[model samples]
Target: MTILLSQEIDRTSYEPAYAQLVNILQASMATGVFKPGAQLPSEAQLCEHYKVSPMTVRRVINILLDRGLVTTAQGRGTFVKGVDIGEAVFHLSGLKEQIESTDRAQVQLLEARIVEAPERVARKLELSPVDWTIFVRRLLLQDGTPVSYHRAYLIYDPRRPIVEGELEVTSLEGLIHGNGQTDLQSGCLSIEAVTLKEEEAAILSMGQGDPAFLIDHTFYDFQDRPVSWGWFIWRADRLKLSATIGNRPPQDQQSAMKDSRRWTGEDHE
Candidate 1:
């Protein structure tokens, strides 16, 4: 879209010219006229386009740079960096525990019940149609602010009665370990950005078009048998994710510490 920068700037207004310029550019960005990594016009081009002085344009660009909305190269000119919400860190834990760690949120257990596994779930858990599972639904809050809705399912074994009760006190992984199931090992997770559906938005206390992070996690035992599966839908505005990718855990363990420190700095920054 061709934004008429000059027309959008109100000359009679009390706002500074640079501030007005920033506002114009921000509006253009919000409307999708400018995109991430898209090159912005040079200072001279902006000066000419807006009918403003070169210094005024530079000042506006500087503001955007500080906000991490754009980055400038020595010779290539300015480019949009998009809005960096900063680093997001996520931990695997029960809904209540995770929210409590933030100290800014609360959690409400919306529903907790045991039910027969659906066909898909039964297949994933490698269970018969008669097998049952515990379904727990919860809402997460931040500083008393509602943020996300989550649902988790664990295959129920009659032999593991302790596992059922521990769900209320510990994370799935923790409960598994407490049950003397230390043989449990790692599994894969998939994450994606999505827009909330109408029903999801109502339960999450968000608008229908609001952004969300959908995470699908599957857990397995040392024998590589799927043990549990969980689905979480988190508000994009409230949560952040952090992950570490590397070679398998080191054998020396000492080297792992050094590697962890290095990656932590890079990831957090």
Candidate 2:
């Protein structure tokens, strides 16, 4: 596709020229003017097109590269690395349950295991360094098309038979809460826009640097104690998040309780 330069360059502005250039490039990507793998105009070409210095154009290219929106080869030209618009649909449920409810996707469990939690995982789950965790990893498919990757960490408890059973048959969180061991209260969650790694992209059937929604969440018990922590990656093009916000708290706080198994983060709240 040919790169078009329509707007006249504004000589005086608070924003730097490179910043403006980045914005234009990003807008082009969003509008599909420049599709993924499409080579961008050379720095010299951009300099002439935007009436900017070569240094300025180079800086703009650097910004895109840092954000994982573009790649450059020494002899080859720069290319678009797919655009991520931060679209994600999150719910107070595990990925399996969420996808199943959609009735559009069939989830496939790729792997599952019990392992020692890393320091970050240990801190999030409030488990001791020596404590173990049941790590559930899986791939989700929509009509047999891969869409997401999930990794869940639950505190190790040998007594819970739920861990030993098939996860497909039982909800891990439901089983944990049903045991009367923990009463889920509330949770904290966070979401951010990210570029998928090569392996992650492969799993999602997308290219590296494709847009993805990185969701990090933590579940808490009735006493406001952390129960589980998880990370999920969803394809941006396939989902969008929606929520109803109210200034006042719910009429019945007890009845407004959400699922205990789902991760809650500030982004979702």
Candidate 3:
């Protein structure tokens, strides 16, 4: 299939052609320009379009394969991998708590203050543009190494001791549900891939423009009103997320498997 690339590698840049191509293809995949199971352009086509050597294209493809983003079939070419959203369900949890189980982890509260809400944060937290919110910044360290950073904005309530509550695990209750709090009621989470900026990289002890995972979460009350919004920036090398797809008893699981086989005609033999 013929593919039209919207961007090309800058040969004059210090970065290699392979790396640039990899990022381009990754962006294409992220934007759904190249849908799942769609065949990537042939090696010859990419080589001609991007003016890169076959080795460069091969290296980029290999990198994609390592990331589990694409697969190459012998003689058939490469195709994007289809993702099943139902297969992975990440729970709402703190980055510090998530890494503390297996590693010696610590969280440092860098800053906590009431600040004018950014337009994006105001929109997310469902607050007016003129409203002020509590901004909290934290750094998570695993085994004494910085691994993740967090930035949160909470709805300001004068009755709630937000700064102190923001420091403790149970404090999320106060921030989310307002003054008298017990536990988390409900929330939402989103994950995306991002590159570190100068400030973020410096804080995380990573190189500027390095890849990382951005986790955005919003907490809501029983009334379904948005209470808080925040995001965590985690080093890509330090985190891995997985989930079990289904919950079934042993007998039920076996029966389901057999039914699937019967439907697929595998039970005929």
Off by over 4 Å in 2: 1-103, 159-183, 242-269
Query: What is the clash count for each candidate, in the order shown?
Result: 5, 6, 0
Q: What is the TM-score (0 to 1) of candidate 2? A: 0.47
Model 3 quality (TM-score)? 0.51
TM-score ranking of the models: 3, 1, 2
lDDT by residue (tens digit), candidate 3, 21-53: 998988888788888888999888999999998
Candidate 2 residue pairs in backbone clash: 183-222, 188-264, 188-265, 189-264, 189-265, 189-266
lDDT of 2 at 78: 95
Instruction: Highest lDDT: give the candidate number.
Output: 3
Candidate 3, lDDT over the whole model: 0.75
lDDT of 1 by residue, 129-210 (tens): 7898888887767677777777877778877554544364335334323445454466677889999999889988889988
RMSD of each: 18.8, 18.3, 21.1
Candidate 2 per-residue lDDT over residues 46-70, each given as its tens digit: 8888998888888899988876678
Between 1 and 3, whose lDDT is larger?
A: 3
